[model samples]
Target chain A: MPHDDHDHPHALLPPEPALRVKALETILTRKGLIDPAALDEIIDTYQNKIGPQNGARVVAKAWADPEFKDSLLNDATSVVAELGYYGRQGEHMVVVENTPGQHNMVVCTLCSCYPWPLLGIPPGWYKSDAYRARAVREPRKVLAEFGVTLPAETSVRVWDSTAEVRYLVLPMQPKGSEGFSEEELAALVTRDSMIGTGLPKVPS
Target chain B: MTRVHDMGGRFGDGPVNPESEDAPVFAEDWHARALAVTLAAGSLGQWNIDISRHARERLSPKDYTRFSYYEKWISALADLLVQSGVLTEEDLRGEADGGEHALANRALKAEAVAGVLASGGPADRPSNVPVEFEIGQEVVTARPAANRLVDGGHTRLPIYAAGARGRILMVHGTHVLPDSSAHRLGEAPEPLYAVAFPASELWANPEHPQDEVVLDLWQSYLEPE
Candidate 1:
């Protein structure tokens, strides 16, 4: 076949180039094709970098200091402001305190809306359509995957941030951190902890 | 129709539930991308610009594509600079003289000194450094923030936050915005504690019972609260 005029570099294929490529891969898979490891590597790189890592510092501070705790419970951004950090586009932040009985999970519902300054880039899953869609609908099912089995009696508030404010989950601090310093407490505050799907418990 | 991102249920939630990221994994090949970048960089002025414009016009139609936002910014800037008289191929490609790298550090340094100047700080202040604020200390969110908070006319507090009442939650030492950079390159000003807020305070919500939100509203955005 003769070379066509469309040979210019930097020319992008029509939209959904990624989707089209995946479709091709799917066809190949149905016919017993490519190894899945190729896909795994792709997911690994972005997934790790998506969000912030604040070990339960915010929660720990809240747990320890009655005043600061009140500030955090009242307003997370202001509490963060108390520490001197601020939000990006998703400014106005809310720290949703999760009790043993009630669990709260936040999704922007608008876009994969996020609190980037506090949390950093959201994990790949946070942005995925699946998380956005189902987190709103099946909060219990999704939380279960994260090893969070909630009591049926508890109120599950799934916040859908619209324009002004964004929500961050303040996970319950670990049991042994009674004497930990603020920095130590902060270390336990992962961005995931604030997101509510994950607990502040450190992995063994 | 609202964008799938808009999420107000214009169309039904559909088969692609928001929670479904398990399968149909995305494509992310760095080698392929690096190759694509090198090749695209090789492409000339109008062609790349046209391509970029077309892509932007169509919202970068390619899916499963992996280009970091910063990567694209640099590529587009480099392309435009090379294409225009601002830079030449000879400028990018230099004869190595008494150095390991082709470009000189002095030449790079000189680029930053190229243009623009406004003020060192706001009128009457020598350095636009911030006055340290204690937690819960009362302060008014500056009327415009530009006049009160910023020593220079540069600021980061959103236009919306001007004159909002808040207290000093923390004192973030002096930091500089690009506005400060372009204007006061040497003068980094004091960063103030931004007050976060409750959404209920800003918006009315019966569904949200006393549901408060927080904002790291800059010191500029707060008045004495």
Candidate 2:
């Protein structure tokens, strides 16, 4: 939608979004405004190194160690940084615990500000207009759409990430997860669970 | 003004199609490049992240909503590059040849990419200014005096939450306010708080009356209630 060529010298620029991107990159690279190799390196970092697994490990540790959980809830930035999960879009971290009576959810009403260090890149739905608008208005209905049905008595707490701080939802440990090891618990931590859109996977 | 990017409480957009947990970090190579370029250009230190965000938000409304997330990133990158004098219009149009100008001093290198991202810049700097609000303090959001609505500039205050009453849930330490930072008007660091407003208060005829919405609001956006 940003394709208004008001001052363009060439009106015949490519129409396809991807082609336009390629053209822009080619121009930037040719003009020495960007480095292709560095671009690849950045891509690799987000593609492989950073992701939900990092947050999953944090969640797993909290589920296993009460002391770690306390540290995570009190000062998540330091605790998460201890595990090498501190970076852009995650400078300030806050972990909200979800209890039986209260469920926690997160949404960025003004643009998509997510915890890239821990959760890697946010899901598409997290950036969708529908989720951004309706998450705060009808969180229950939104959660239900994600197949997360909670008890009527439970109150939902939706966190609108409006500032520099980023939030990670610490879902209630599922029943029967007591005997599971930390590694196993991490396996059950789904991306949606940490975002508060869905519950953590139960033993199945 | 309430930009298209500030989408809170408005509805009827469409259904949400969530990808699987293991979905790829980027849908295409261009997306990766877009992100990389944005980050690399940002490392030049000419502008901050908040400025970059404002660049994206300042796009035309049709462009703001029409551009896929990464497309927005690339568009913003181009805008920033041109505005910062790093690239000319001819350069973006692909009409200019290489060697026209010297590159920015802080251009990211391949070897330093991992190190740069791993040792990411944190925005939470301590402030000497005294905090204005405290946890559990009841406060009302500051509203535009005449119209009863907040508008204009790059503000973190969402339209829906403006002029609402809420209780401070937590007093997050002083940090850079995006509104001022986005305009290169200094950090303007202030005490930010996680304010909790009842869902019923934010919306009329709320579906979940007992539910609460917590928003991280800056001190400047609130008045003691």
Candidate 3:
């Protein structure tokens, strides 16, 4: 027999931000300007339907297929759309490849513009003042903080999301994974790796 | 002339703190609500995305820095709702009765969410003017007179990139000009390009000498160097 856990209680203890959201929702719903059901759909779409997994799958396919990789690097928007992933902030897609000589990183210094359909909502750190301010000036130093210390010889290329175009970094495939299947490679693709903040997991 | 939101190359922002690998998309339930509501209201067609971005940038410097990411979104959404005549402040404060709905028909429905998200609003508009610059051409971003801002309105050109010289990397097709579209003036499509600035050119003392920063700038923002 097991006892019920009491860590999370079913109470309406909303925080300040939560309270503000509740009030806003109430007014909007009353005015018939927004539908709560529709709001739920949007939340569910981002929370469950969309995420970095989509980008990881795209990366794995590129890694396993040479033609796909070429097409992705050349025409990223159409290539990703072929995978049934295209919309929202990811309408204009640009896939930047990371190599030993040139390391690619993406940042929206003016705002937090991310590829929502491919990478989902922008992460908290990506929207932070510190990352937005320092990434352009001291990318190598920022990478070091993220535990991604590149060689001093390798030049770091930072792409600012200044306009509608969104970027995704296709990280380098690890050594000794030549025989890995697409599914196996996808499993090794981490979210941060696609964001240029961290690398993919090494095959076990 | 520099807005508080343009935070590139600014100093004293402290160290970067990345969240854990397995962090959830929404840190709190309210964040999800905030994002969803904002997006839903935006689908009402009252204002464009650029207008919404301008609203966020319009926040005061103190409030902008103090508020959390979602806090900014929620706060801007409130102001936009009132400004667009979708709802009034009295309604928000529960001090007045809910009036007849004029924009109710435009409310996004749950069933249409997937399709709406899949078919995003594209900004690429055909341009009649010839592209003034080409790939590999050296160009410099427009710089207003000292202490003057660009139109004192919504602009994608950050302060750090202003007056900086860079080479054109790619010739992106004409897209809707945000500076005009934000003010509901017109799309005013123009040539967009990916400009690459060397670290030495963008900064006085470069941290990574070999590195470069790339930005997608409009034709109007660039001039022959």
| Tens digits of lDDT, candidate 1, A48-99 | 4323543245566786787887778776755675554453323456677777
User: What docking tier does model 3 reach?
Assistant: acceptable
How would you encode candidate 3's per-residue C-alpha lDDT over A114-191 as one tens digit per residue? 999888998899999999998998998898899999988889889999999999999999887797899999999988
Which 10-residue window of candidate 2 chain B scores lowest in summed lDDT?
A: B144-153
lDDT of all predictions, in order shown?
0.43, 0.82, 0.86
**Candidate 1: C-alpha lDDT:** 0.43
> Could you report the DockQ of all the candidates, in the order they appear?
0.08, 0.59, 0.39
Which parts of model 1 have CA positions greater than 4 angstroms off?
A1-51, A202-204, B7-225
User: Candidate 2 overall Cα lDDT vs. reference?
Assistant: 0.82
State the lDDT of candidate 2 residue by residue for A51-111, as single tens digits. Answer: 9999999999999999999999999999999998887888899999999889999999888
Docking class of 2: medium
- Model 2, B1-225: lDDT tens per residue? 457788899978766777787777788877777778778777767788877887777677887777788877777767766766776777766667777346544668889887888777676678877888878889998774111221345788888887899999998888888877877777878788999999888898677667999999888788999
lDDT of 3 at A168: 96
Rank list by lDDT: 3, 2, 1
Instruction: Identify the candidate with maximal DockQ.
Output: 2
